[model samples]
Target chain A: MALAKVYVNYKQSILNPEAEAVHKALKRLGYGDIEDVKLGKYFELTIADGKSKAEMDKEINQVCDKLLANYNMENYHYELVETEAAQ
Target chain B: MALAKVYVNYKQSILNPEAEAVHKALKRLGYGDIEDVKLGKYFELTIADGKSKAEMDKEINQVCDKLLANYNMENYHYELVETEAAQ
Candidate 1:
């Protein structure tokens, strides 16, 4: 099994000027569908076999804490998506 | 063919406080792997068939300009990695 990660955020966080510029351009493009446009990160990782879901989950948790997450300006939530084989 | 995106960041741009904290922790971890670690974003997308590379590149540029990239404090660089099948 493999693990993937996705992060969602507003491109401009009152922190990133680049995000703000994109936000302005998006507004001009008439994508008025959204009130605020946020940007996020996504990751897809392949895992080694022979480990249970629980073990994988533990490792993933550690990775998120140790490497994947910032836990300050960016807010993150995670989910597990099954590939066709698993289904 | 499909489109994939990867965004690299320093984690802490002297802008994101959370990324800064994580950077500090990493330094203390004793891995001593490097002087600094930056965080990045990665995306993998499945594209509809029948599009040429140039066509896809155009669309990707639009997406990055209109959405994915902030164009301000955060700088972004992109590359496309072919999948195993293509190789």
Candidate 2:
């Protein structure tokens, strides 16, 4: 099996309220050294076997676009890692 | 600057409604081959310089405990990568 670990975050041009709130809180809590904090969603997907890397990538992108991320507000990127099923 | 990519996910023993909902939706969308889907929060933190890795790790853990993750219901882990300040 293959696993795709996806990270989705708001576009840099967009204002992320959640991140801003957290950043302010961090500063208030005396974490003044933290330059920035960007918050996002992380997803772990277990992909079935027998697909080429290219095919899997395509499927992953389709999933991200169709179900996972809101493209107007967020951008997503993923890293694929192979996994072995228990014998 | 140093970057810490934190991933916070609910413990396996706990029931995650968000993941369950997404899993069901994926199946409805014809992604039956996806064995499972786990959702979590990803945080990108920009840490200031002049701190050793050990010091940063300790501070990261403190921040995670106090502000980021709910230790009672969720578990958090992170990978630290050194980043050069933009010239």
Candidate 3:
């Protein structure tokens, strides 16, 4: 099997109000040293391993573009690791 | 400054309906090679650097336990990196 770890985050130009709220809450909770907080989505995908690395990369990118991320506001990147096949 | 990347995910015993939904969606969207999908939360925190590595570790753990994760149903882990101090 292959494990694809995808990270999706808002674009730098986009304002993330949810992250701002979390930062405020953290400060109120006495974590005064936390200067900034940005929250994003993480996904782990277990894929059937029969394709080449280049093929997997292309497919994963297509998945991200179609479902995992909003091209206009968010960006995504993924890392693929080959794991032992399920017993 | 220091950068702390935190990842929070549902415990193994917990039923993550959302992840299941995503998995189904992926299949319906033609990503048939995707065997399973797991979704989680990721956070990047920029913190003022005045503490030793040990101190930072303790503080980050406290932050995760108290606010970032629900100890009853979720698990969290973090990585810390020393970055150039914010101007």
Candidate 4:
């Protein structure tokens, strides 16, 4: 079986409210050394089938492109992992 | 200034609802080599301080401990990076 990971994040320089809130809280807590913050989402999946690794990769990529990811303002990237077949 | 990253994931044995859904969808589309799925969250922050890297690390750790991370059913770890001081 293969594993896949999809990570989505706002592009750098884009102000992130989530990060900003955390930064503010940190400052209020007296650790005022932080300047900014950003957040990201991650998705992982295990692939099982009789297909080739390449086929799995293509399918995973499609999942990302179609539903698992949103590209309106966030950027999405993914990694495909191949593991030793189980005994 | 230092940069911080927090990565949180469900424990290995924990069943992930999000991942299960993705696995089923991939199966419906064919090319299903996936057996499971899991999800994670990521946080990044840019810290600016007159303090040393060690000090920043300490503060960031505190932030993690007090807030900024949810430890219930999730495990979190962080990395601290010191960037070249802006000239």
Candidate 5:
């Protein structure tokens, strides 16, 4: 099997109020050295191993564009890792 | 500076309905080969560079336990990467 670790985050130009709140909270909690904080989404996908790497890449990209990411505001990237097949 | 990428996910024993719904959605969308789907939270934290690795590690652990994760149901991990100092 293969595992895809996908991350989806807002574009740099976008404002993230939740992350801003967390940053402020951290400062209030005495973590003054923290310069910035960004909150995002993560997904783990397990796929049966059969397709070639190129094919897998294509499918993953399609899935991200179609479901996992909002093209107008968010961007996504993923890393693929090989794993032992489950019995 | 240092960039910390933190990932928080539900523990295996916990049921994640959102993730299950996503898996079903993918299957319906023709990604039948996708065996499983898990969703979680991701955080990117930028910290001023000064502390030793051990200090950074300890601080990150404390932050995760105190803010980034729910110890009862979620597990958290992080990767710290050195980044160029801000101009």
Candidate 6:
């Protein structure tokens, strides 16, 4: 099987309210040394066997573009790892 | 400076409705080969200098326990990478 570990985050130019809230809370909680915090999404996708590496890569990109990420506000990057499937 | 790249995910035994919804959507969208999907949170923490690695590690754990994750439903893991701060 192939596993796609995806990380999706907002564009740096975009304002992220969630991250701001967390940063404020962290400072209030005495973690002032936390210079900055950016929050994002992580996805683990397990792909079925039988596909070649190139095919899986293309599919993963498609999935990220179509569902896993909002291209206008967010950007996504993924690491594709091959793993053995249990019989 | 140090960057903490944190990944938080639900325990395997727990059910994730969001992931399930995405899986269903993917299948409907003709990505039937997607065997499974797990959703999680990603956090990028930029830490200020002046702290030792051990101190930073402890602080990060505390932060995770108190803010970044819910032990009841999720778990977190992180990679600490050293980086040069912009002067």
Whose DockQ is greatest here? 6
Residue A14 error for model 3, in Å? 1.4
In candidate 6, stretches whose alpha carbon ends up further than 4 angstroms from where it belongs are: none
lDDT of 3 at A72: 99
TM-score for each candidate, following the candidate numbering: 0.45, 0.95, 0.95, 0.75, 0.96, 0.96
Instruction: Report fnat for all candidates as fractions from 0 to 1.
Output: 0.13, 0.88, 0.90, 0.88, 0.90, 0.96
Tens-place lDDT per residue, model 5, A1-87, is 999999999999999999999899889888998899999999999999899889999999999999999999999999999889742
lDDT of 2: 0.91
Clashes of each: 9, 0, 1, 8, 0, 0
lDDT of 6 by residue, B1-87 (tens): 899999999998999999999999999999999989999999999999999999999999999999999999999999999998721
RMSD of 5: 1.5
* Candidate number that wins on DockQ, 1 or 6: 6
True contacts kept of 5: 0.90
Taking the tens digit of each residue's C-alpha lDDT, what string does model 6 give over A1-87? Answer: 888899999998999999999999999999998999999999999999999999999999998999999999999999998888721
Q: What's the CA error at residue B33 for candidate 3, in Å?
A: 1.1
Residue A32 in candidate 2, Cα distance off native in Å = 0.6
Higher-DockQ candidate of 4 and 5: 5
User: Interface Cα RMSD for all candidates?
Assistant: 7.9, 0.6, 0.6, 1.7, 0.6, 0.5
Better of 3 and 4 by TM-score: 3
| TM-score for the A-chain in each candidate structure | 0.69, 0.93, 0.94, 0.74, 0.95, 0.95
TM-score for chain B of each model, two decimals? 0.69, 0.95, 0.93, 0.72, 0.94, 0.95
lDDT per residue as tens, model 3, B12-40? 88999988988999999988999988899
Query: Looking at model 4 chain B, which ten-residue stretch has the lowest summed lDDT?
Result: B29-38
Query: Residues A22-86, candidate 1, lDDT per residue (tens digit)?
Result: 55665687533223333466443344456677766765566566666575655556565444442
What local distance difference test score does each model get?
Answer: 0.50, 0.91, 0.91, 0.73, 0.92, 0.93
Best to worst by DockQ, what's the order? 6, 5, 3, 2, 4, 1
TM-score (second chain) of model 6: 0.95
Tens-place lDDT per residue, model 2, B5-52, is 999999888999998999899999998878889999999999889899
Off by over 4 Å in 1: A1-87, B8-14, B81-87
Report how far residue B62 has shifted in candidate 3, in Å. Answer: 0.4
- Can you tell me which runs of candidate 4 are displaced by over 4 Å? A12-15, A48-57, A84-87, B12-16, B49-53, B85-87
lDDT of 5 by residue, B1-87 (tens): 998889999999999999998899999999999999999999999989889888889888988898889999999999999988752
* True-structure lDDT of candidate 3: 0.91
